[model samples]
Structure formats: structure tokens, C-alpha cells
Target: MTTNTTPPIPMDALRTLPTPELGMLLLERLGKETRFLPQNITAEARIAFKGESDEADLLDRVCEAWAWVESKALVSQVGTKTSDFRRVTTDGRKLVADPSALVRLAAADRLAGPMHPALEGHVRTNFHLGQYEIACFAAMKEVEVAVRDTAGLGHSEIGVNLMRTAFKPHNNGAGGGPLADAGAEGGEQVAMAALFAGAIGVFKNPTSHRTVTFDDPMEAAEVIQLADLLLRLVEKAKVREIKTENE
Candidate 1:
């Protein structure tokens, strides 16, 4: 659904300095003895080297490196917005001196919560940049694709109608089948059908058609998790159990 396959590393910079050397420079920029002021770092990073590189491009690489280390809590921003400064933590210095002290900072978790493995390729990539709506939409598209495949439906069957057709409960007079266990009491089947169909209608459609704001990553995570739950249910769909009888 989303083609965000860009690896979060600058290859050329890594080749030139390696992660350790680059990490140490970041530490130096952040100050080993004293805190580095935000203004000074920006000014220093923008100075071009021997006319071989652009200042802005170099600044971006430097900032990208810092963001990875900062996310790992190795560097902390001091003071309020007006008077911001950065200081390398003791752990940060350890990583600077010995980059192998721990696993790579770039390889660490991007968010506080665990991202579903299913979402890693597309959905979570968008989420990494606070693009919550895009992540939610990608996640829902994943659910739609999963349901479509599970139902043996063509691309023609889409959105809510596809969901309804696939999961519509068979009341002994149906042309289609249930998407979940047609339970002994029949209520579970009915509820499952409604849940899946409703989820596609409510969660998938709006995000697919419009720009729905999901302000926070927590909110986006919850929505993506909702799709995760529904997709797991779709995985349970099978033709043999499409018409289970009450026992």
C-alpha cells in the first residue's frame, strides 16, 4: 500500500566515516566536557568542507545521525525551547568510544510500543515520521488485502461490500459464507461478521478516501492494532468451516 522501503541510513556518510567515527563526531558536537549549544552545532555543521559538499546536505546527515542517537536517549536536550542545549549522556560517551558497546542505535526501536511484524514493511514506516493517517490507511489496506485473499474474492469486490459478502452470516438461505467459526450458538458468527464488516466500513473507508487526522502515535498504534486484530481473524477463514452446524 505504501512504498516506504528507504533504509534509514546514509550509505555514503557511513562509508566515509563509519558509524563509530560518525557517532564520535556527534558526541564531540554534543560536548564531552561541556554541553553543545543548538545554535553552535547548526553553525558548525553548515560549514562546507573543501567545496566538496553542500552545507545543507552535510547538515542533514549530521542531524539524521543525531536523531538516531537522541532517540536512544544517548543525548538529551537541555533547557526550554528558547534556550535549548544538548549534552551527551555517559552511556552516549561509551557508545562513542566503543560503538560496539551495544547494538546499533539505528537498529533500536523507533517507538515505545512494539510494532506488529505484519506492519513493518509499509504501515510502520509511515508511522516512523508521525504520518499517522498514512500509517492507518496503509494498515487498513493491509486488512482489506488479507480479507480479499482469505475470501477468494477478486479485486472487483472492495471495501464494505467485499467485507459484507465474505463475512455475511449464512441463515440457511444464503448465497455467501461466514468468515469466522459459525458457532454452536450462532451468536459468535453473527458478531464476528458484524465486527469485520463494520471495521472495514468505519476504519478503512474514511482513511482511504479522506485525510483523517490521527494526531498522536498512540492513537495511530491503536488503530493499526485494530486492523491487526481484524486481519488475524481473517486468517481464520476457511471454506471447510464456512458452514459449521450447531452441536
Candidate 2:
């Protein structure tokens, strides 16, 4: 005698069940457990779905919907443990309260802190989209490194013109891609240069306390680079020799 081994029930099967059954399954899995069932297969949501179904298909379709949410990789646990995020798709109850990654990103200030260790280090190199504007600046720096590495790219500094041009390739809503604010012209270098000058000025003349200002994007980018480089230098310097603000 041969023992039969069958694959698990497919989510698409859920559709075969009447509306009452489907609704109950959804509620049962989601913990809201309702008796209503929707038999209208012509509904936009049902019509759009394409997936395998399981017994009476109610339970299966619920899984299918959750699968759609998971495919976006934008799933997150809200009003609950972050560790529970992964459990959202397994059960309906979890998804009901889980919310989307976009939601979490919007509430990032309260849901979590800046770029927790859990964020992906690859791809976007960002923890959240709405509040992680620093990542945009960081991306510019990484791009600079990449350009430098390429033999023909000239390793140009991400000045205002270059920074704005960098975004030209992408067009989002309103014919322009969404992007972080690139500080005023002369850019990061200019800003950093001024900051460094201030720090240096402080050392040179402790009596003159004029505030430093950079009005150009290119200048700001240069300043940022200098500051970063100096920070690295300070990090490497001997304990007694370190005199920077962070030191």
C-alpha cells in the first residue's frame, strides 16, 4: 500500500465558499469572527485576485489577501511587538492590527527610533521613507564614493547642480520625483567648510564668536565631507590629541 502525500490547501479555494462562509473564515482567522459572507465574485477585490484556493475556499482566500500584503515587503507590526510583525500573514487577527510598512514609516518617530539595527543595510539603505531624510544625504555621499571608484566618472562632488541633476532621472508625482531637501546652493561642502572654519576660528581666536554661514550647496557638500573626514580623523587620533567637539 502506498501512503498518499498531498500538498497543503491553496488559498484560492476560499472563493468557492458562499459569502457567509468566507466572511466567517476571515473573521475566524482574523479573530473578529463574523457571520456575513459575500457571494459577489464580481467584486473588484475578488476579481483582481489570482491565487490557489482551499476548502470551501474561505480560509484560503483570506490567506491570499494577506499574501498580497506580504509581497510588498511593507508589512509591519503596530500597536504590538515588533517581533510579532513576521506573524501578520500567518493569521488574520495579526494582520488586522499589523498595518503596512508605510504606516509604520509615517509613525516612525513614535513607533521606533532612528534607523534601528533591523533596517536593511542594502538597497535603499534606509530605515523609513518619510523621516529618514538623512539617508538621502548619506546616499549622496555613497554615490560620490561610487563615482570616484568608476574610472571615468571624475568623482565629482555632489554640488547643488549635480544633486538636483541626480534626481532628474526619476519622475514621481507632479512630474518630479519625491526627494529630501537639498540644502541651499554651494551645498553640504560649503556648510561643512564654514563649520570647520568656526571650530578652527574658535581655536585661533577665542574672543571672536561670529556665527559661520554657508549659502551655497556646493560649499555645504564640501563642508560636510570635511567634517566627516575630520570626525574619522578624530576617532583615530590619540586620546590626548583629540580636541574636536565630539572628542
Candidate 3:
């Protein structure tokens, strides 16, 4: 008789694993089996996870992980019938062959949400290429260009100074900068200037003078999203300038 010698995976560890990780675990198992029913997979996971207590919870998590794999198109039904049997997809096999692909997949998933039209290509390409710092730099560069173009400032006016000058509040009966909201209170306008100036000073300036590092892709995505918001603000400022000119 053949001996079954596979070691049981600890349930404690499986409980804490992220959905994607759990999905990958299931995918790995499916890759070995070639085809499997969802319930059988869940049973197998329960046994492999050593889930004697809270079996229902373990089964639910396994099912959820399986669903995530299916949602990602990593697995496909084996036939035309409404059957639970599924086989790993070509992409799934590729992912299994190269574990690093999971990192790229996660990065792509993080950036899958809606972004500013300006950043959709530039930031994402750099981010996907693992150029996190360059991704952030490219995003903030867009903000700087939008600010300069909206305020009609020359390229010589750059960085924090450019942001301050472009968004400077009205004072002493003098008109505010082109991007500044003239109708707003001086304090509010000053706050806007400080907001833009601070963002440029912190996020944009260092990337220009030195090599900045961004090890965390999620953090880099947040920086890009911030740039997206600034771009929208610049567009609003441009619209306000046009309206003011018409008036």
C-alpha cells in the first residue's frame, strides 16, 4: 500500500493569510491535481490545514480563496456543465511558474482603480516596471507642469517657489495670483498656497535634486493619487481663471 505522507498545513497560519495568498495556495494544489471540484478542494484544504475545530470557518475561507482564483480567471470550469470541477488557466500556470508575477499582479491590481487621465499611462508604466520613485516623480511633474501652464509662469519658476507664486493670495487691495481664488478670504487663499507649496516642496523637489527611494509600491500609488488630486485642482483653477477673464 502507498503511504500518504503529506504534512498538514497549520490552520493558524492559513487564518491570517491574505485572500490572494490563500488563492495561490489553492492554485498550487490545483496545479498538481489538474482538475478538482470546489467542495473537494475545500475538504482537501480542511484536512491539509488541520482544521478539526471551526471546520465551517475553514471551509468558508477555502471557498472564498477559490472564488478569488476564479474571479481573477486563474481557474476555468472543465466543461460546459455547471460543474464545480475546474482547471488552472494558462495565466495561472505562468503565475505558478514565476512567483514574482504575483508581486506584479498585486501592483497592477492596486492601480486598477480610476486615476487622472494624465497619470493613467505614465505613472502606471513606471510603477509596473518597479520604478516606484520615478512613478511618483512623473506624477508630481505633471502637477508642476499643470500649475505652470495654468498660471502662465515660465519654466524658470519651478518647485515650491512656483507653487507659492501661482497660488499666492490677494493682499493689500492687490489681485491674487491667476490660480488663486480672488473671491475667497485671504486666509483661505493663503491656505491653498501653502497646500500646493507644501506638496511640491515635499513630494516634487527632492526627486529633482537627488535619488529618492520608494520601496513600497502602495505608498508610491498614494503619492500618485495625491498628484492626481492636485491636477484636478489645477484644472479647477484654470476654469476659474477663464470665468474671471470672461467677467
Candidate 4:
């Protein structure tokens, strides 16, 4: 006589769950194995979900859910003689230890989808990992770099001064910076400078000097979005500068 083994979680129930939920379940399974081959995990998942749905379709869903886990950096492909093996990362272990973080991460990703390409790297990664202050700082720092590059300023000019010098208006026989909008009213130009300076001062500078608390993820996401807006403004300024030079 053969005895059947029961799946820890019913495969039928798992099928109805969302990507993050499915990903979490897969992540927990990965944690149990410690190290595994992607194909092997998917094959096992297929067996567990055997009668629940079409075999190919079930395999595709499991692979996609596992892919989500990889995308989020939960599991890393081990670098050994072969590339077929993967191990759960430290972050993945933490998530398995406290699944609440994965829920928070999913919510944050939904709120901050398709972030500016400039911010999609470090800023998004840190934000998803619950490092809110670091994410905010990195976003604002990208804004600072955009301003500096657009204005042709060297590395020595930085922080609020970089923003001021970059956006300083034409006034009192003084010429404006390359990024400054000469066509705009003098007051508007000055306000533009103030905008960049204030953003750097409030969001970026504090993180550099000391530890700043950002307990609320929603507020942190908004701050990163603000940085995205500032980067767009800098891009516009670059185009304006080029147009001014051409004319």
C-alpha cells in the first residue's frame, strides 16, 4: 500500500493568492531547503499542485511567483562551479523570520511603482528593504548630482551651495548659472534656487550628518517622489540651457 504526503499549505488555496503572497510562500519553502535549484523547486511545486490545475499552467505560475522572489533579491544565485544553485539572502532570511516585512515591502512597491530611472536602483532597493531614511537620502542625492551636472559645476561645489549656484538668477549685473532660466522673472528664478536648496537641506543633508528617523513608509515614499520631481526639473533646466546656447 502507498501513503500520500500532504502539502503544508493546500495547493488550491495557494493558487488564489496574489503574487506577493505566493512569493512569500515560495520564500518560506526556499528557507526550508536553504539551497536549491530553481528547476527542482518548480518541479516539486508542480507535484504538490498536481491535480489542482493544468500541469503547464501550474508550472508557469509557480515559476513566475518564484521569479518575483528573485527580483526582490530574496534569493541569490550561488556563485560556485555551477550556476544552477541558489541560496536565500540575508534579507530573505529576515523576511522568512518576520513575514510582516514582506507585506510592508509589497505595499511600498505598489505606492512607488515605476520610479524615475535615476532612482530605480539604490533608492528603490533601500526603500523596499525598510531603510526609509537611506532611500530618501539617495533620492535627494541623485537630484544634487543632476543639478551639478546640468550646471557644469565641479565636485567642490555641493549641498545647498551647489543648488544656489546652479539656479542663481541673472541679477544686479551678475550672470546666471548655466541651468538658470534667464527667460523667467528674476523672482521666479530665485525661487527655483530656493526650491533645490531647501530640498537638499531638509532631506539629504540630515541623513549625511546624522541618523534621521523615517518611521512612516508612506511619508518616505512621498519624499522620494519629491526627489523624482526635482530630477525632472533639472532635466528641463538642461534642455533650456542647451536652447539658450543654440540661440
Candidate 5:
């Protein structure tokens, strides 16, 4: 005789459930039993999700989701291992009151502080929805705007040219501005200019001029963090105002 094991959760539905939402769901069930186990949560989820979903399909997903919440400190564990667990944590309770709190907390951790206040809304909202490419695009756009506003450039100047003007090392005809001053040496200035310029040219420009799709949140988050770093550099950049004889 053969015994069948529970199958994995459906990837489609699992992906649809963001981590915070998953945590919230677990909190609802685990509330009934103050002290719980993975199997208990799994059984509860299977029953709740039945008819709407396959019973065998929910076990692994519920377990995986709960483990993540526990690891994140949103849920605490009791006895030794997965066999015994605890309910919602202080952090988890905060999320229950305000679902969006998880996104803010995550953004803070991912960014090591508040992301540029300007960029936070876009990053948090779309990121939770799995819209990684849009989040990255919006972030780079903030960098572009910051560079433009700092440089006193017009709308006509964009992409590579804008970055080149704002940060390129001072030369005979054209003098580099704030970004140039931010760098230690002339070469470093040029490189710094190129870094932001390249980021905008390669990432921002494409997204602005067309649609770009990114499937992996990790990859998109990397780019968003890069944009964050660039924005931070801009924030620290020293603007040198050149005064002519007229002034």
C-alpha cells in the first residue's frame, strides 16, 4: 500500500499573497490557539481554503509563509522547532492594526532608514504588488529630477546630457557643478558623473521612453537600492554657484 503526502501550494496563489498578508492570515488562525504548531496552522489553512483551494496544496505554503514571518520577528516561536510556535508578535500586532506598516518597516530596513521621502510611496506600494520594474523606474526618475533641479537645467536637457553637465569635471569651456565638487579628484568627478549618468541612461531612460519588464523582485530591488545610493550622493553633493561679473 502506498501513502500519499500533501502536495505543494499553488505557485499562482502563493505569489498573490504578499508576506504581510500571509502573516496576517496566520495571525487570524493562530489567535484561536494561543500556542500552536506548523501542522496546526497548516490544518487550519487547509480547512479554511478548502473548496476554494485544494486541501493538499496549502500545507507547504502556509508553513513557508509562517516561517518567514517568524524569521522576520513578526511571529515568535515557542518550543524548540517548527513543532511548537507562538502567535503574533508586537511587530505583527502593529501590522494587524495597519497593514501598510509592514511595507514601511521593510522599506526602512531595505534602505537602512527612510528612503527618499519622495520615492517611498512608489517603492512601497508597487513592491508589495510584485510590480518591481515600476518601482525601479519611479526611483530612478526621482534621481533624474534631483539632478536636474540641483543643476538648474531645463526640461529640454535630459538623460545623458543632463548628468554630464551636472557632474562632469570642470573643463575649459564648461565647468562641472555640484557633483564635481562632491568628488575628491577630477577623474573621480568624471567617474561619479558617469555613474549617475549611466544609471539614468541605461535604467531610467528606457523605462521612461518605453516599457520594461522585470520578473524578479531581487533584481529590481538591487536597482532601486542603487538609485537610493545615487540619490543619497546627490543629497550630499555640494553645489558651487559660479558668479559672473554681472552678478
Candidate 6:
């Protein structure tokens, strides 16, 4: 008997692609082998595993999913690499030889279930966004922490005493004028200016109003910007996945 065994790969599970990428892998590897069509795999059965299932059976399903992936052209292998002189093997003229197409093919192979492509793409984009959010949060907290650690030091860079003071809107009668008069900047900036001015005026009168009434981190412009980027990336990937599914 010849020493040949095509290691079973999840070549069929990737049925969402056209004949070029995902399907191409399965077409090349399991060309002659009989395979099951995706139509035959019941949706309820596939979903049932998502709920209640034994661990071993889940693994079997994963393997079955892989086998299906192989069939669907999701994932493919490089074939055996035996170094023996007579045992050597090579692809025949029947297979597609183009190298560039394999990248999408390889991507299709690695993903699972619906939105696989989009999910994978989102994973990349979201990962970077997540890292950026973490960095910003760190920077914001560092200032607060710095103010606490340097209790006595008079450092202008990190405002410890300024943070301790109260800043609130002013509704009292004053020559300075109302909050939304002829010249108004922003609600927050206006609130800040009023609050500081009021604090100075009410310095001797401590029973006037509450101090520092601003929403914590109310202006997450940077975080919001990052979130917007991630949302668009996910939405775009989702649309692509939807298209791929129908294909």
C-alpha cells in the first residue's frame, strides 16, 4: 500500500464563499471525495450545541465542523512533506496554482459560524481600540493618583488643591450677568466660569450653594471617537459577512 493519508482538515465548514476563496480549498483537496451539502445540516441541530451539550460531543462537532470546513473550502493543508526520493508527491494540473488567492482562502478557513469573516476583522480592529481606551483611562487616573501621592508638593502640572475646590453653576443676582447672556461658550465652560466666579464671591458666605457639580468624565470625546471607529469597523464587517453568507 502507498504511504498516503490526507490529514482530515476542516475544509467544508466555509460554505459562505464563492468558488474562488473558501470553496477553492475544498474543491482542490476533496475533489473526488463524496461530501455532504450544507443544506443537509439542520440549523436547529447546529444551534442546539450552543445550549446544552457534553464536552466530548462538542469536540466531535468541532471536528465535524472542521471536516465540513475542508469540504466547503474553509481551511486547507500544505500536504505531506516526506523527503524520501520515490515517496515524493506533487499537485497535478487540475488544481489552481495562484498564490495570492490563498490569503482570503486561509482567512475563510480559520473562522467559524455566521459573521466569521466580519468577526475576525472586528477582532483585529476592536483589539487596537481596546488598547487605546485602556491607555487613555490610565492617563486620566494617573493625574488623580499623582495628586494624592504628592500631598505636600506644589506641582502645577498635577493640580491637587484645584481638584479639591468646588465648581458649580451660579443662579444668584450678580453684575457678571446670566449664564446664557450675550456671550456663551459651552454649558460646561459656562458652568465652570460661573462656579469659579461664584466661589470667589461666596468665599465669605459658605451657606450659598453646593460646590463642584459637574458630571464625572462627562466629556469622553476621545473615548467616543474611538468607539465610533470600532462601531463603523464592526458594521462594515457585518455587511460583508451578510453578503458572504448569501453567496
Best-matching candidate per TM-score: 3
Please identify model 1 stretches exceeding 4 Å from their true place: 1-117, 172-178, 238-247
Please estimate how well model 4 matches the true structure, expressed as its whole-model Cα lDDT.
0.82
True-structure Cα RMSD, model 3: 4.5
| Candidate 6 residue-wise lDDT at 134 | 33
Q: Model 5 off-target regions past 4 Å?
A: 1-69, 73-113, 172-174, 238-247
Name the runs in model 6 displaced over 4 angstroms: 1-133, 139-247
Query: What is the C-alpha lDDT profile of model 6 across 1-247, one tens digit per residue?
Result: 2123232223233324343443344335444433333332333334434433352454355445435444543333334433311110122113345444344233333333332232234433432333323333333333333323322334452332333322222234332222122123447535544443333233312212333221212222233233233334334434543564598
- Residue 221 Cα positional deviation in candidate 3, in Å, after optimal superposition: 0.9
- How much is the lDDT of residue 232 in candidate 3? 95
Question: Over all chains combined, what TM-score does candidate 2 have?
Answer: 0.26
Over the stretch 105-148, how does candidate 3's per-residue lDDT look in tens digits?
A: 77667678888888988788889788988989999999999999
lDDT of 2 by residue, 1-247 (tens): 1123221222344536543334333433433322212332223233344342423344345555445444533233443453332332333443345434323322332323332222225213342332233332443344333322321224453333333332222223233211211222434434433443343333212312333333333333343334345344223322312232244
Off by over 4 Å in 4: 1-111
For model 5, how many clashes? Answer: 0
- Name the candidate, 3 or 6, with the larger lDDT value: 3
- List the global CA lDDT of all models: 0.65, 0.34, 0.81, 0.82, 0.69, 0.34
> What would the TM-score be for candidate 4 when compared with the true structure?
0.58
Question: In order, how many clashes per candidate?
Answer: 0, 39, 0, 0, 0, 17
> Which residue pairs does candidate 4 place in steric collision?
none
Error of 3 at 174 (Å): 1.8
